[model samples]
Target chain A: MLLSHPTIGRLVLSAAVTCGLAVPSYAEDILIGVATAQTGGLAPYDQPSLAGFRMAIDELNAKGGLGGKYTAKLAIKDTRTDTAATITAVQELVDAGASIILTPCDADATIAAGQITVAKRIPTLTFCGTAPVLATAVGDNLFGTYPGDNLQATVIADHAYAKGFRKAYLLVSPDSSYTAQLPEYFAEVFKKKGGTILGTGSFTMGQPDFSAIVTAIKALPEQPDLIMTAAYEPDFPAFIQQLRAAGVTTTVYGADAIGTGTVQGLGKLVDGTVYSAAGYPTPGGALEAFNKRFETTTGHAAESAYEANGYEIGLILDAAVKAAGSTDPVKLRDAIAGLDKLPIVTGTITYAGTNGMPVRAVSLIEYKDGKPVFIATQTPAAADVPAPAH
Target chain B: MLLQQVINAISLGGIYALLALGLAIVFSITGLINFAHGELMTLSGYALLAALMMGMPLLPAAVTAVAAGALAAVAMERVAFRPMRGASVTSLLLTSFAVSNLLKVVFQNAISARGKPIAMPDWMAGVVPIGSFTIGVGPLMSIAVSALALLGLELFLRRTVMGAAMRAAAQDFNTLRLVGISANRVIAVAFLLSGVLAGIASLLWIAQRASVDPMMGFVPVLKAFIATVIGGLGSLSGAVAGGMLLGVMEVALQALLPPSLAPYRDALVLSGIIVVLLVRPNGLIPAVDTARS
Candidate 1:
């Protein structure tokens, strides 16, 4: 009101005109609240994924803000891999008026943040919440960017069955929700496909000795057709080394955790190791282009599967916002739920009837010469798997 | 299979034994747990990695790693712990923790909080078969190195004046100081020996795991601490025995537990430890003359 006085209003108008002539002003930024672990134990996974998300955001903004009206700005909050920190970070972002919230890769770590977004009625997308029930369990506002764990497990089971491996031995790290769930889903799908599970073993995280597991395998009446396990590095490589050292030549299969620089460091030991993870880009595709850009930007080629997941989440959010035709959270959430065949850098994500699970292609890759060799892309049929046990 | 598993047990036991001995040495002299002892191992591993990356030969790199550990231990003594020499036990214990966390944060910032891969020589990671059994060379080396280091430590303690001084200090530091022995030198030597053991242990550890992280020292240190407690604090031989027993128990349980019950093997081991403690409140080998006024 003070500025609206006749003489003052004229002076302010002249000053605004002068400033506007010197520098163009951008419209208000559409805020994206990204809650991820940038430090602590999870940083190895979260940092790379966050870089991918940043790349995607940069790419989107380069094309002139979302709908040419609002620039998509990130309000990144580091959860430090702590539950309390995740809650506080998400709350701060929500209070700061984030239109949608993005969460970390692990379902367990993101649960608190998901609760906040749900309570606030803000649409939330997790970059790599592979657990089957993360979406339904979290809330109606939660959407998973990656395919459910059941899908990847089913993908591995189907591929193994196709390879004529009907008898399998399973090993799991009962250390985290991610590792523990792999064997369950794999057993479900493999048995449904008429494969028999010969034996199973479990261990804690950072339990370096796999000698007992190897001994157990050797005790079997006959060698199993396949050896399957859910593991991450540095345990993964050590386990493989010990298994090979024990002269157990049976073929091995693992989850996406095997697809990391850690396991790849195993050199020839990694050869012929088959694993299922989220797909990367096809040649000359958007993901391929993004992968190149990512290498240049981060000074390292995308090293983990979650990196792709991180990039895919941003593209997914953009598509949902465009489809909703408004920034309203309810309409955006509805549109996100209804998204079908949305082309992403990783693959097409369809969210129509998946109970908030994204239906996307899971990659079947074999290790050859210390790098993943693409075998084939697979979309597991819903009939070939059992429903998640909530 | 039984013989092979025994080999595994010995291999695992050797690491715990060495780590426990290191912690025990420092604890015996200072009555401080020296939780930061693990960071000495971590620093040595990182130092070795850096030296190797800089094209240093394997032998010299190993030496440099050990030296790095010793130096870090001495540095910690001078910079963090020395000033608190006459402080209360509670403060000293808390200082060790603060030092441990501070070192971890420094490592996390300077290097990485996550595991960084270290290339092992083919010989280091190779396996050798003796008749019907195969033993990992890395594990074999751990056993041999621990045995040799233990022998050396034993000889030093019994035969050398400095080692005798350490023993004297462990029993009664104030008395040793009253006799005109340098308390500062005795403490520094104790730290030096502990760091050297940690450095050697670090090499063996990285060989098996093939990677090192800030938290890499955590599990080993935790196991070592448990071993020290089980063996009897302030008793070096007890620490070694405790570590070996724990290692054997863990490996044997892993091997013998039925497939259906294998997942609970660690819990079972912990239960066994609890039972043992219940039976013997002072641990398996109570330190001599620990009934201090």
Candidate 2:
């Protein structure tokens, strides 16, 4: 009786056909290469990006494959999160006939991959590479899904000026290339806004003790209203906890690194700190729909800027493929460069030039009771900050 | 500022002291650096994490961790170290390195697969305010536990007859064998004591960070090596003194240097060690008998 029902019969016939023919008929299988550090120091960033990328791929396939003909097949190679591994992974992906390649997380690995892709004339995208030098060196073949680190510094400085924090203590890690540049950027912005640098302190990476820095900060004659640190995840939590333990409860602010799991792990100790991030938590329109779909597919929260950037990178790549009408490397690159204003999960992204930085918006977030609450979205003013002379 | 720096130095020193003491005991008896010693500490930390996850209370979890460390050491001696006991020093050293690498890989995979920071209980969080400065309970507990462990170790090495046998074996295992003492027993006791010290160190290290990762042992072990070398290589008292001295020097350097020079702190400390070694090649406190030749 159930089999005889019209609706049930139609469903059975559709399932049989899909199983027998629909999946087997491959008009064209477009292979996209992903080289990421799935198992090393960069695993935290890479693993989540992998999840996001898969979610995007699944959604794209469900919506009738890219270019209205080919279904995307993501071939992933683990870079082991090392520079040497990243190079090898990229080579492997290229060997596997990947037309478009997604590179690893950090600047060094991403840059290395970018060089290879550029030499090979393949289109490459990075989800979280923010090294300023990379953006300047790489040409049109390379694109970043996230805003540059300069935007993060500008946003923080603007937010701090708005909050009446005119006096700031800058703490940076001299050993880190990333951290070293942050204070310089902040100093340029804060000084321009008429904020005084009260004092400066430094800590070494991998040094667990922060008491000395905390003691020095406490010893300042007039306490600064804000403490701005440019530190990585492992060091950030220790620095904040020790700063609080030393009875220095000054409002803390930092660059995009503050928006990582390391800060989240600090729990209540991270309360009352604010930072500038490249992406917003609650995206609108298509992004909102994508986020919901991403969460359902990934079975984890897509809350981080890195995850959003990864998802957006997938969407952009899909769009470029569709626009190019072919998987040809040069055509895809040209199509991507020609996009005037592509709305992504983060915000509107416009590629100014092949060598120029992409125009992207930044968001300011404040940590209230250990959660990064949305504050305001603002496009940072063009940085008037001069780069340090060689 | 002086008092705070001194307190910071002592607390930092306590961690080093525990690490060095654990290494010292094993080296004194086995004549091996036991490169795997740091990994033992890491293994104990992970064991404690596992125990905590299994709903054991803090104190019981700590005890289990210590037991696990001791058992792991015993197993290492039986399987790896014991086979190459009388071989060239190079063979034993290579075996230790191999053991360390194997453990590191296993722990790294285990931690990564879990993909979360090892959780600590709620009671261990926050600071206990005292006067103008607030001290973290973890650091305070580290100092206290290290002191107690050191005291207990001193008592065990001096008071018990088994302790006398251990000392004799360290001095001359062959002579101890002639005196009808089992060298195996002495070696086992040394491993057990080292495990206990490593377990205690793991607790303090975890308390300070409130998380455990496989790479956690790398720095601690390096510090321990430095402490042992700065302390007379074979002297237990030297280990303790050297650990305290290193901790104080590190804090002092941090306080004195400007922020820009902070990254060079390690280089500066190593330079100081070289100067000390140049002045006293046998270390700050040379081993009493070994210094003669």
Cα RMSD to native, each candidate? 7.1, 7.3
- C-alpha lDDT (0 to 100) for residue A20 of candidate 1: 30
Off by over 4 Å in 2: A1-33, A58-75, A91-101, A114-118, A137-141, A283-292, A301-303, A324-337, A354-357, A383-390, B46-109, B113-139, B175-185, B286-293
Clashing residue pairs, candidate 1? none
CAPRI quality of model 2: acceptable
Q: How far out, in Å, is residue B178 in model 1?
A: 1.9
Weakest 10 consecutive residues of candidate 2 chain A by summed lDDT: A17-26
Candidate 2's DockQ is: 0.27
Worst lDDT 10-window in candidate 1 chain A: A17-26
The digit string of per-residue lDDT tens for model 1 on B1-293 reads 78778878988888899999999998888888888988999999999989998999988999999999999999999999999998877898899999988888788767875677776776765668889766667667778988998999999999999999998888888898999999889989899989999999998887777777776777888889989888888889989988998899999998877767877888998888888789876678877747520
Best by lDDT: 1
- The A-chain TM-scores of all the candidates are 0.88, 0.85
